[model samples]
Target chain A: MTTDFRSNVAQALKQDAVQTHFRTVVDRLRAHRQAALAGDAAFEQLRNRCAAIRADAIRRLPQLLEQFESKAQRNGIQVHWAETTLQANRIVLDIMQRHRATFLVKGKSMVSEEMGVNAFLQSHGIDCLETDLGEFIVQLAGEKPAHIIVPAIHKNRREIAHLMHGHFSELPYSEDIETLAQSARHFMRDKFHAASVGLTGVNFMVAETGTLCLVENEGNGRMCSTVPPVHIAVTGIEKVIARLDDLPPLLNLLTRSATGQPITAYVNMINSPRRPDDKDGPDEVHLILLDNGRSRIAGDPELLKTLHCIRCGACINHCPVYRQIGGHAYGTVIPGPIGAILEPQKQGLDAATGELPQASTLCGACAEVCPVRIPIPAIINRLRWESVRKNQQSQNSRPVVPGAGSRRRPLEAAIWKIWAWCCSHPGIYNRLTKLATRLRNRLPAGMGAWTVARKAPKPARSTLHESLRTMDIDHE
Target chain B: MNDARKAILDRLRLSQYPDSTPVKCDDQNDPVDPVLWPDERIDCFINRMRAVRTEVHDASHDSWLDILHGVCQARSLNNLLVSPHTRRGAMIYAAARRFPALKNYSQSIEDWKSELFTAVDAAVTSAYGGIAETGTVILWPDAREPRTLSLVPPIHIVLLEKNRIYNNLAEAMRIQNWAMIGMPSNVILLSGPSKSADIEQTMTYGVHGPKELIVILM
Candidate 1:
């Protein structure tokens, strides 16, 4: 299917409510992050340390995965590997079937969202519930998460009140945020108690200790992982860190960057299933390590930076494009600068995802706020080249990215070729420019998408070279 | 599944550089500098906790039970969950008549799941330690005190020793030798009561977990 990026953006831009919501939410988030980081003198050093830690982890990803698997298995935690989302979904289904568990309660897991786990389970006659408040709101509304961290950020309090009232007829309609939250809590309490299995996403996987770390503000994560008999944790393969010591700095950076909190309410570390002597905890802990195009991403040294993202959503909050159009406009799982670079690589360049890279102003705000310091703008430029480059074949060498050069147009290529040729020869360039300058008024005002919201550029009355020569300035 | 593992490992291994040096990660430098004085740490911890809307009460070992009784009476809690096997639980049990009806989490969650989810009014558990920098309480939930005692109840009262407050998470982990000792089934660093800003970024407390977290620092 072709991407409706332009139309989606058009639709999002026209929604005044969404625009106001994005502005208010992102501004508050930006201020929160700034305030959280303001007093710390070591903030820059902490970010550098975090970036290095992630870089080191990605560099040693294969070995770390092996170590984590062995250590986790020794700890009596079952480890599953999935090369694709389909494989991952099947593994989850198989586990649920093995336990005869029809009810699943989940914490906020972007990877599970990547797998479309809820839809997959529901289709198979299983009851899947989102327990995180934001996710629950989005799920109740039959919508995808609008933002990575704040899933229901697109909905205002009034909209949420209506949605909650419509869904839970017993609850009174009130726009009070706390009342709405409490209603959700009351509704989910039974679900949590009844859920046979729980699933969550890993914030970081410590290979040294075989520990799965999850950070969240809601107690739903703890409840889901602890309350259920079976706990399944899913994460991308790249989230593995070499040692446990790497966690504190990364956690510090993540909380500060994500929501401007010194720390979240809960930073849960799961080392194993409940011990035989333990009072309460999951009997079985299963961790799914999903590749899902991340291995290919690691093959390219420059593009490998994409995997270092901690999914803090700080970059998204800081992105100018995302600020105006909001997340839905991007039409990807994770949106803004990070998604622009990631979705294309994961979905291949020829697919609808290829259009995502163009949804940026390359303002460098994302890179600036990025805790791990992924050079998002540089990566965006590289992907743009990868999408439209004419060099599809080069003897024995194959492109690292799938569908590379699929977006190249012969007309655009020919135009660039002519422009290059003219620039090399000054005589033809000077004559052509002079002729164009004389006939500047006859030039069309329209220039495709650029002219849609902007005036088309007109040639100067005289070429720069001619003007310089007339003023007795050096032509060079 | 095994084939998938092998294939993914192979692809990742192929991407590795032949001469990549092991990355040196320096963890010695503390991100948040450790406060030197015990008094400073305690003060900082209290400030941080109170900032997050957590109720912190300074109490002596002898007077903590009285404070607990007052807290229960103030909230009009009908029932409080406690782990009777623990020392503090035993103490509370000894003076059980001063507080509300006391319940022990001796049975498996499967046995008392309904009461724990709906009936429990408050819970009192012992914290492994407190992190001063983030105002976090560390709980290594195990046999004595299950994970849900601190989670399921609407009001969670944690008793933290004054000496156990560390400057930050890294220091706490190191001093406690968490990596060497091996992690419990779950280790929670709780900074505040459960909260969410998901609804239009408006801060809402008690979305899924305990709405009120009261730390009895002794």
Candidate 2:
């Protein structure tokens, strides 16, 4: 519930395992991304195409959604619309209840996490199983997803092995990565077979053809979509694109940026539910278009560019702040620089996400590597400004404003205020400098956190202004 | 549902850029239909696919069945699930007769889906074509070659026609003209075997789907 990032960062850093895991995972991803894009001639051109398509799609979203809905309906796929997470969950549950679905196999859908779909469905007496290995590991461990692409990136192999060993006799405490994968595969494969319905996230919906694309390196996405009698895809309204031609560049950018793969192992373009003549594929396919705070962002000119994000996660991989603490510290469904800005947009600077804007070093790496060219740092700064401005009215005559960086250390603000005042009034400034030189030995103490990492340079006995004046007097 | 749809669309419309003017992307930037020299495409396709641990075999239509037999024999595997409705599946059924050691499963896609999950060792399906740029094998699966044939079993063997290669995904889709007509119910592009690096960033093959993907280029 808390996005008190400073404390979370401190705690995360204290865990040697956490630090090591982040370092290893981010480093590998960084290298992989670099290699994947290295010498790819079409990268920049394709990036431009992707950006253009997103802009176009957002501009014409209503039309595209309408077209997609009609086309999908024609394809015999049922489409549902949800205005909020609660409504979206209800829609999914109603579908499940109608189907008499007991257990569900799920692909990795960040939107599902946003809606708390699993918890909601489970609470309503339907079991939803996460088929993605990372998701499964994290789900069994009773933790929320930590990263967007690799949810269990925070967990080391030994930790994963332990979690699996506790649950399955097949594992019997094997730490080998391959052995662990086999055990999980054996364990989840049956669930896929038994589950009557599959739920997945849509990477992009090609409006022209009414195709829903799900990209994945593991076959779980394919399994979840194909094996089940019923399939439901949950996606935000922002995921739609204008045409099938827009897919190549977007897919290229996504795969390269997310996992540094030339392509995911499988990319399923679901055009419809199983055709009457088709043998395998979902007999009933449903798509839930959820608009939980995204339409407002889309309408906003300043913040609308954020929707251009393909969720490639390159920004997260390249973010210095994200690399330091990993994703879970942010306490949002999506984490890192993207999450920091996006969460505050959905939930205005409240206690839960109030500090997210301040959690950055403002390093522009996230922007540099952002395939969609989102100015993330700019957005975070805007959120910070809004937070501070909002706090101003609340903190009437206070030394510092609440919900602002200056408020955390009011003494620092007071000192700076005094300095500004003295500088404004030359007579007082001269007097203070002379006094400071006179009593240089007896200055204030306890800078606290600042003095911990940084050495305080003792202010020279004579101020720079005083020294300059003394030299001028001597020359005269 | 309709009420929700209208409400969501209205909210989106309200928030949209005031001008209805769409962002104009350069038409010049649009990638054209690709045409590559056959040798160049084949080489590019093989290297890209193999880079991701895919086993790519270059074969003629005459030698493809022999190559398939060799692969199955090398693995000492049996119980292959083939979509008998497909031309490639029929070819496999005919070819598999020579080897009494091999057992073929051809139940209807749903009837044997459970066996495809548990008992089936390998499954072969006919691919629609190949994408040379990313080394992807495209499958427009139907009742004949159902989607599960390529997904469920531990090993997936796809029979891809060589001349059907497209330089990139966009070109392939444009040529397919799915939007103009109608798209297949499921158009899948498989690049390699199922892989996961979720545990310790260690890449492991065959997490939930096929462990091995062998693409036979004919």
Candidate 3:
């Protein structure tokens, strides 16, 4: 996916300023947090417990994932393994075709976006609908999520009212949120029961009990998984945790981090579909565990910590950079601090995405706010080195610069040649520097691009070596 | 066991690095803690519960019935569907009579679970069962009371009476232990209405579950 980073950042700055839209969401999340505190002290206790459970599960991720697959298989859930996004998309399309589904009702799944599932499904003539309210708004707008937790944060009431008025002919243009929401509510209620297949993103895949944990503020996730005859959950392999005991701590961190609440409005743990003599749930459940560069990341000691992320977006919310640019500018599915590291690795360190790593100010706010403690800044820097290395290798492998002995570009060779001359002749360098310092004030416009955002300090009158020699006169 | 699982587990066990050690709870006959006397513990529990996103009510007032009636009238749920648990509460029956078509069920959770999907217009279950952080419900998965009652219904109205709300999930889990001889087959955590954001990444409520979720906090 191509990310217009500059435009996304500009848009984020614009929409976030509007008090009615983004502020209302921020207020509601705060209200949810306050309610959690008011009603139950145990919310925090369970949150802590869920966190510990997740931490332990991550510690034994590979084993737990294997266990989950086996158990899920026993429960009649067909498990498919995809090493990359291409594979994941293909698998989902095949499943949709097998089911002969025309309209696919989907739940909020970052993994699906990561794999470009919608486009692939659409290309195959399978129409998919995003059921989450925030996701629905962004989908209609034809844009990537601005915020992970609240994807439509950039949209205000007027924009939503306009969208609803345009989409629903029966509804009048109303600025009221409740009235607008009711319109959307009526729009999707039937789509849920009508769709043949349902798609969801797994929050946590428990290995011990072979259960899938899905936490959502709305009941749409439950409907997507249950109402449809066939349910498909696309989750990264890293989602698997070892035991049920490890759920509480992760849930705690996820809730507080995502919404500042003790827990989400609902946490649905499904072991299997409606069994024999059962009245509810999907008839068949299929879980697709996606690798898509995750295993490669998991093998690396430095990058593995990212897998511990629960997609809470706390880091994004707290990040000054993310708040300024929002998620779309990151140009990757997982945005903010996590995106800076994961995107380049998941895609490549090629030119299209090379500017992303450079986008960050190396601010540790993302790391600080991260519940599982992913070192986003460090990983970003490492990716920069990898990108540089790839650039050097390509340059080295190129044919000798046509007429010269050098195999590098003229610009590269010229820069290095100048550096060699300066190092080999320090006295000449000192004289040239002095001359430049004298002419610095007289330099023409566009002399430097680096100094536009900042100013360069004036050079010293004399070289350090010369000053040292002059000071030696006192010693004599 | 598949070769993958065995291989992964073997590598983990052989590793020298320390991993999480599981702790076993010692409640065989009575897993739940009976004594609720510690004021500090209660206070801590209440404070933490408030820290999450639930509203707490002071139960000191004798007019709990008035509170119920007022909340019902406000949410426009005078026509209610209630579980047997609410019948035991003081003046709950009087409040039920106010709604002309109020449907009351004395059936077990299993029967109610099935009936809720097709028959019940708006279903209400007890919230006195669970704890704070997760907002989970402790439903014993037996022949009479199935796990689907809380999830399948379109509009599920959970009744969390004053005394039933525990300080945290630990106390709730402790209660779950005592309710049955051992751990029940299922435990559910409900935080909000059923929703989805699958189509073009737009969130539409009432996707698979109830469209409108109203909590009558009395």
Per-prediction CA RMSD (Å) = 1.8, 4.3, 7.7
- Candidate 3 wrong stretches, greater than 4 Å: A1-59, A390-448, A460-476, B1-119, B126-128, B133-155, B159-166, B170-187, B192-218
lDDT for each residue of candidate 3 in B62-133, tens digit (9 for 90 to 100): 654455555566666635565344353324555557542455544433344444555555555555365543
DockQ of each: 0.81, 0.73, 0.20
Expressed as tens digits, the lDDT of each residue in A329-363 for candidate 2 is 88889998999888877765645676788889998
Model 3 lDDT per residue over A317-389, tens place: 6566765565666777777777766766666555345457767888787776566667788877766555544
Worst lDDT window (10 residues) for model 1 chain B? Answer: B27-36
Candidate 3 has an fnat equal to: 0.21
Q: With candidate 2 superimposed using the best TM-score fit, by how many Å does residue A120's alpha carbon deviate from the native?
A: 1.2
> Of 1 and 3, which scores higher on lDDT?
1
List the candidates' TM-scores in order.
Answer: 0.97, 0.90, 0.74
Q: List each model's interface RMSD.
A: 1.2, 1.6, 7.0
Order of the predicted models by TM-score, top scorer first: 1, 2, 3
Q: TM-score of the candidate numbered 3?
A: 0.74
The worst-scoring run of ten residues by lDDT in candidate 3 chain B lies at B23-32
Query: Top model by DockQ, which number?
Result: 1
Q: For model 2, report DockQ.
A: 0.73
Error of 2 at A443 (Å): 5.2
